[model samples]
Target chain A: MHEASIAASLIEIVIDTAEKNKAEKVTKVFVKIGRLAAIEIDSLEFAYDAIKEEYEIIKDSEIIIEDVPITGKCQKCGVTDTYEEMFFACGACGAFEVELLTGEELTITEIEVD
Target chain B: MGMVDVKAKILEKNYSKAAVLRDKFKNTCVLNFVSSPGSGKTSILEKVLVMFKDKYKLAVVEGDQQTTNDADRIEATGVTAYQVNTGRACHLEATDVEKAMAELGYDLDLLIIENVGNLVCPSQFDLGEDAKVIVLSTTEGDDKPIKYPVMFRVGSSFIINKTDLLPYVEFDVDKCIGYAKGVNPELEVFQASCKTGEGLEEIAAYIEGMIAKKKNA
Candidate 1:
């Protein structure tokens, strides 16, 4: 449901960026989504598609979503590892005091324009 | 076509608005309560309103998908509360809070935003609150923090509501605390029962202390 809001924001950013770059058409937009970002990629894509049609600059743009895995650094052992949300304990030390390094990101990395 | 490296966060607009709202709330201690539908949030809020009414000027922003039931409940306590109906949206945005706060006028020491009763989406959205307080009832089970780590992680405090029901329920307090600590080591845990007013004093005092500290600073 809130994916529509996110999509609308993405389109706003894309259009503003495209116009600032003096591009007439935006062909692609690259989005990075983390595993723990709690976003449904399919739903986000659907929302983007629904919203992009309203903006001429990004109407034909294709959104490329790249999923990033959750990565964390152990507080005690100083070991960084990729892990699942449920099994967030450090693989090396089995400590629960692991600090999240990634997998919470929701960013726009790049955009292609002509 | 040339590739433009537009490295930016998709939610920057909301974040920016939230930052502005945070600035507006810098002098006030704002607490956003997140919980499940039946976690006694409204009940606890009513008690808290009555408890702290004399100490500080307070206002509440109630976020719900529909109905002004919660706002009416708060107003019945004689506290000015604004209702932000988010329609199908699961959480209150900063803009919603800003509008409600403006309508509430500026003579308040504390602003409590009772977010829509959904833990998942509210955890992701920052409503310019100084602290995100999660309310968990003993009847909701103790594994909630572990099961919903995102909500637990974002919360600055966990209010274990309906504690008077502990004798009738199978909720293990220690286990719940341990699970919440596992997710958020810095979480301030409070045991409270809105029915008996068991730990409402401590909660009120803590919040009052926070407001005083903010005012002094």
Candidate 2:
């Protein structure tokens, strides 16, 4: 449901990037999403499929989603590591006092265009 | 096909607009509150309005799916409140706040934007607030911070509302605070019961202190 809006924003960014480069058609869009960004990739792709037809340049464009793992630093032991679980505790020190270093990102890194 | 390395934030439009709004509010304290439906957000704001009405020029931007009831309630407090009906949209975006700010004018000592109910969507959008406050009621369970981690992680403060009902409910205050702190190490937690007026003074003082700090900075 909210993914539609996210997809709309993404399409707008891709269009702007495509136009700025004077590309005739957009083939693919590379997007990086962090684990904590709270975006569902499948829903976003569905939204893009429904909305991309509105823009001719990106009608056939493919969205490539790259998942960014959650990485953080422990405040107690000063250890930095990546965790697949949502607990996000310091793996070495087992402390919950940790600062998130990354994995909150939602960015478009590149675009493939003709 | 040719590839263009146009590395940019997907929500750049919103980011840039939020940046502009942040600059505009550099001297003012803007607080955005997120909560589940019927978590006492409007009621809290009404009490807050009464507490600070005589001290500062306060403005509120109320976001709801429909109706101006919240705005009307705020207006009854003698403070201007802008009602933003998002229609089908689930959350309030930075653009919505920008328009609301335009309607309310820029001269304000404190601005509070009460986000639409729904912890999931509002967490994804940044409305250029100085701090995001998450309000939780005791009846809602203590695992909310861990279940809805995004909202807790983004929020700078957590308000445990409806504390007057604590004796009736099985809400562990310590566990709730611990869960929230685990999500956000620097999160400021406050316990308040709007019905009994408990903790409202402290909340008001905290906000006033924030406003003073921003103005002095």
Candidate 3:
């Protein structure tokens, strides 16, 4: 799964930042993944747990994931709506020119450390 | 315990590597072809690539789980092809492309990467390609675009392959294009069939246009 690769990258970032901050151990890793990012949260957590075992700094860390809903603003009618489906058709104007406002994120906002 | 504000993308490492590759491929029009297994990605390449092999310096990086068959077929077309057997990996990462380029050298006008025959994972990994050309054959359901919207969203060009089978299959070309457009309105769509050689010239022209655009840039 691509989540395994994403988890490895997340671990790399966490270790790099923890070392730079002079932290002895990392306790929590916080990340935000959007609906449109196409990532499965359980798969990502499984991968994180599996990969974190190799690094002592993050071995005991727990990952906190915030799933973001896909939202878009209609480019034609200026209406904002949360998209449950993959289609981006505007809810108000029925235009396909809806500009995505969120739900494509794959960012780590913060981490807790000792 | 203190919270260290990292505020970074999870795949930042790959993105950074891809950025470097993008810079290195300034003169090379690199296109990553992605699709499900047996979507005729290599077939389209085997046919379309021969059209430009004599006119331009071209090389291919074939990604598969464990075979050199695709690479060998590409090489038979009189072009350089490097096979990257990803072992257990389902997709090719930017590091894989970098390693392939190390062996293939960077003296090419065009670099075609036939991604591991997967639609889901490959869309997430950027291989420093100018465009992600997605191939979908008629045998696959027309609703595949909506089913795999992320791939359609990231892809620049969409190819509906095996148009020769349209008369026999239940695939609806218009509905498929509509679904793809619903996800990405900017996608350039094309219908192609390798067997009858229908709609291949336009695909070749589109690739040539990309090569020219990269060279002029």
Candidate 4:
């Protein structure tokens, strides 16, 4: 669901940033997405390819997506820990009730243009 | 080939627009309603409109991806209701709501948008609502909060409808409260049935109270 939206936006952001930096073309786009960001990477790449086809600067662009783990705070023990979605429980007290913290990021980690 | 590593989230456009809408709603206090397909959201709205339409100046935006069924029901209450069909999207976006407001074509005291029948996609998209009320039924079961934690955690209020069917189905009211409290301790929960009119007064009173607070503020 998010792949199409994410890919379309990614291309726009890259082209905009590349223009701002006065670059002729963008070769690699590095994006850091969190575990709970709800994006499908494979579909995102496919959509990116389709969208980039019209962009002269990003026709051969490479997208490297990295997954950031999610952090949660336990209500029972006040323990803060990091875990994937499948293991979304308090690591210290084994409580299923936990407050999500910091795993919902969709950030542009870096941009390389030359 | 020259390489440009760009890192950014695509939802920045949608999320930021929602934030601006939230700030605007803080001054007016709009209540958003979300529920399953057959959970009686429009029926409850129709009943409430009957009792309070004369007491208040009301405008309603009915959000359905396909039809104007809910808006048609609210219109019979002698109130002007705008129907917004989201087309293929599962939920109403802040931009969609902004258009609905323009199409309403009048002054208003209270506006309610009954979102699409979904607990997932709708929860993620914000319509600049001051408070969100989620409707669940006795038939939907007690484990709803556990299964759909996203909606339960985000909603400001909960309406457990279909109280008249208590004898026919197995719904543990205590368990639903317990699970919801475990996730969000401050969530205000209410129980009512648009069918029997049981426990409906409390919700109507709550809505009136909220409207009064907004006007005073």
Index of the highest-DockQ prediction:
3
lDDT of 2 by residue, B128-207 (tens): 88899899998999889888888888898899999999999999999988878777778898999999998888888888
Please state the error at residue A48 of candidate 1 in Å: 1.2
**lDDT string, candidate 4, B48-166, tens digits:** 76778798778888888898888889998887889999887677878788888777733566778899888766766667777889999999999887667667767888989999998
Ignoring the other chain, what TM-score does chain B have in each prediction? 0.96, 0.97, 0.99, 0.91
TM-score on B-chain, cand. 2: 0.97
**Best to worst by lDDT, what's the order?**
3, 2, 1, 4
Residues A15-96, candidate 3, lDDT per residue (tens digit)?
9999999999999999999988879999999999999999999999999999999999999989999999988889888999
Error of 2 at B2 (Å): 1.6
Model 1, span A1-114: residue lDDT tens? 567778888888999999999999999999998876667899999999998888888889999999998888999999999877544668998777889988888899999999
Interface RMSD of each: 1.8, 1.4, 0.8, 4.1
Segments of candidate 1 deviating more than 4 angstroms: B167-170
Q: lDDT of model 4 at residue A18?
A: 89
Q: Write the per-residue lDDT of candidate 3 for residues B111-201, one digit (tens) a residue.
A: 9999999889898888899999999999999999999999999999999999999999999999999999999999999999999999899
Measured against the true structure, the TM-scores of the candidates, in listed sequence, are 0.94, 0.96, 0.98, 0.82
Ranking by DockQ: 3, 2, 1, 4
Q: What is the TM-score of chain A alone in each candidate?
A: 0.93, 0.92, 0.98, 0.83
Q: What C-alpha lDDT, on a 0 to 100 scale, does residue A4 get in candidate 2?
A: 90
Spell out the clash pairs found in candidate 4. A27-B3, A108-B7, A108-B8, A109-B7, A110-B5, A111-B5, A112-B3, A112-B4, A112-B5
For model 2, how does the per-residue alpha-carbon lDDT over A53-80 read when each residue is reduced to its tens digit?
Answer: 9999999999999988999999899999
